[model samples]
Target chain A: MTRRVVITGMGVVAPNGVGLSAFETAVRAGESGVRFIQELADRNFACQLGAVPPLEASHLQVLTTLERKTLEASGIIYGLLAAVEAWSNAGLDVPGNEEDPDWESGCIFGSGIAGAEVMRDATYLIDEGRVKRLGSGAVSQVMASGISAYLGGRFGLGNRVSSNASACATGTESLLLAAEHIRSGAATRMICGACDSGGPYAWGGFDAMRVTNRRSNEAPEAASRPLSATAAGFVPGCGAGALVCEELESAIQRGATIHAEVLGGAINSGGQRKGGSMTAANKEGIVRCIRHAVENAGIHPREIDAISGHLTATLFDPIEIEQWSVALERSGSQFPYVNSLKSMVGHCLSASGAIEIIAAILQIKGEWLHGSLNCENLHPKIAECIDPERVPQTFRKHAVRTLAKSSFGFGDVNTCAILRRYDPE
Target chain B: MAPSRPDIIDRLHRIVEPYVEDEEALTSVDEDTNLLEDLSIDSMNLVDIILDVEEEFGIEIDDEAAEQMTTVGSAVDIIASRLAAAD
Candidate 1:
């Protein structure tokens, strides 16, 4: 029999705040963490800046030593810090600090651009006519797998380390892999999630894609408007999110508080760019992933009470969600309360899936779903996507039996995870 | 380090043959065979192939080279250039 998997602990280094308490408070208040970037002078992009976590020098100081130089936009370091907090929360002995060689734990993390900031800075130096400015450790510093490896070594996890680079879907994919590890008896416990810190490369890339909100330069906080009819495009954001997944029996034996049950997850590739566009989100592929996850979870669509949507404030996302809704309708399932976190946090790319799962878990725990922060007008098509009046309202009375979150990324990678609410009653 | 074109092709086939499903379809594939069309390798798998080649050759293919590796011939040429540069 496959052991049931549950999230024991969660840690977030998001724009709203760090740690569980701060995140809970922000989510409950429906706070917007989107902010403007004053450093970039070019007005070519509508949004000058994005909502980024306020980094303390002390935070990076811990990850760096005299012997090892740290990478810029040290997202891996941030992820490690969050992992430590999650470990502490789970009441597990720090891995490397313990002498036990047989500790059964692994790490699977996701990142869109692991050390993009490092590359950006190095490239800038090379562009500035300084041939010697390139650091020799550039590859190691920017490797996407470095974060997972660092976590594994730091926590004394023996050998089992995986890193995913599915752009926005990376976090959710990590969770899926972690759940697989537990089900397949590969690891008894796992740290599964994702993180990313956008540097100039990300900014430039998104800018070139012309998918970023450029008009919200004046209203940085109100820029990311998911489901809103006026939304121009998405805003670039950065953050880290992680969770500790343990076998249900192991968790129960440890007397750990079960947050939610990882029911199932599915991943699929959308064949060749549709409509002659690479960035065009594939509706069929998106629906297949959701359906597969729902089927794997052994739950009908009617059972899902809420959906933490991957609705970045882009033109195509709402349409994708609409297609998803049409599929749900065809499946004879109820349309759950659907909303997007990108409206509040901007799009964290690699950290997106993990963060969305975190939000779903919190909604299950607190029995409240945060509302769209700046959605003055719901997209007419998605206006019926969910109840528009439900915006900015909290739902405590409804028993959330199941929740689903979907994440999509470049290369048409689609991943969806379904979670079952943990009821104390 | 200077692997012949045939050697490079053989090695690439070894790396990608497992991933390629239509064995009969790919059996007649030549140097000009487009990886995307002939082998039907997806972009994500293409990334895996590049990483595999990097580890095997101990040479990094820059983004430009990686992007240009659309066909067997291009991949071989890119590998050759990187190997020569490294030497």
Candidate 2:
């Protein structure tokens, strides 16, 4: 029989901080992780930067004896922190818990780019001095799969070690793929998420595309206004949000504190229609994923209390999400209270989906939605996208039945994962 | 001058023709026939044809030649030119 996967525990190293408690405080307070690009000024680029929490490299000492030789940071640190938190949350020990060994625990986290600092340092080594003096570990450090392999080795998680690179959707895809593995009986548990270290290349790439928010230069906090009509664009941020998903029965037998249920998930390519258009998002693809996820979860559309959207604070992308909302409405159910995390946390690119799902899990756990900060006036087209009144001071006690997490990537990749409330009793 | 290498034409046709859905209509297609407008191959399929041609001809196309080889005729010309340049 197929196993029903559920998130037993979650840990995050998001732009705001390194733990779920810190992340929650930042989200509720509507903190902005974006800051002025100090390094990019040397490159002559005009884009704001987002950095993950200052490396308390001391935190990693418990996991590894490797000294902090270089500040070549990426999402790798966030991945490690999240994996460790997840391992503990699942009541598993390093090198695997007695009940479910590390060999049965898979690691499937990803990042669009890895070890960006390594590249930055490597270029400096070659351009400023000698090529032969370049760091030998540079290539291995920056490999896109480095985070996955590193976590796998660090924790001895040997079941399935791999990384998915579907641009911004990578993190969410990693989670969905993990859930699929559990459903297929391929593994008993999995650790999945996406992270970025936050730097100039992230800012410069979006700057070249003219998408990073440059406004509120004086007030960096207000720069990431998602859903607000005055919203400029996205502010780049970095971090990792991960969960420990296991077969529902196994989690209950072990008395794990189940956070939420991975009800169902669906992924699809945005075909030519989406592929041909650059700024245009394929509403059909988003609708299809949502529809399939809802159907697979065996939940009626009305039961979906909220949707955590990709909402990247882009001009055209928000409109695409609104279109998705309309499509959902046409199916005879009211549009779920939709909110974008970007408004509060800034757009984290590859980390967006994972972090957004983190919000959904929290919403399900707390039974309340955080209001979209910096959205003074909502977009008139989807003004009902999110109800501001639902924002709460603390985790709500009521059971939020179902929530959908949606993400869209550059190559027209639309992915949705349905998270449901699981009662462990 | 007309090309006399029947083997080259056969190999190229074998690589390109199989990918085209409508084989019977274009069974007698010559090297000069357009791949896009004439054969109705979309841009995406044209890219696949480019990859297939490169593998069959054992020629590495530079970025400029890749752009120049938009149509089948242009692609054939670019491949023949690359071969001549290499020799």
Q: Rate the local accuracy (lDDT) of all candidates.
A: 0.76, 0.71
Chain A of candidate 2 compared with the true chain A, TM-score: 0.90
TM-scores, each model vs. reference? 0.77, 0.76
The per-candidate count of clashes, in order, stands at: 4, 2
Residue B86 CA displacement from its true place in model 2, Å: 50
- Tens digits of lDDT, candidate 2, A166-188: 87888789889999998898888
Query: Candidate 2 — which pairs collide?
Result: A96-A102, A366-A396
Per-residue C-alpha lDDT of model 1 across residues A78-100, encoded as one tens digit per residue: 68767877777887876444376
Q: In candidate 2, how many Å is residue A103 off?
A: 2.7
User: Individual DockQ of the candidates?
Assistant: 0.01, 0.01
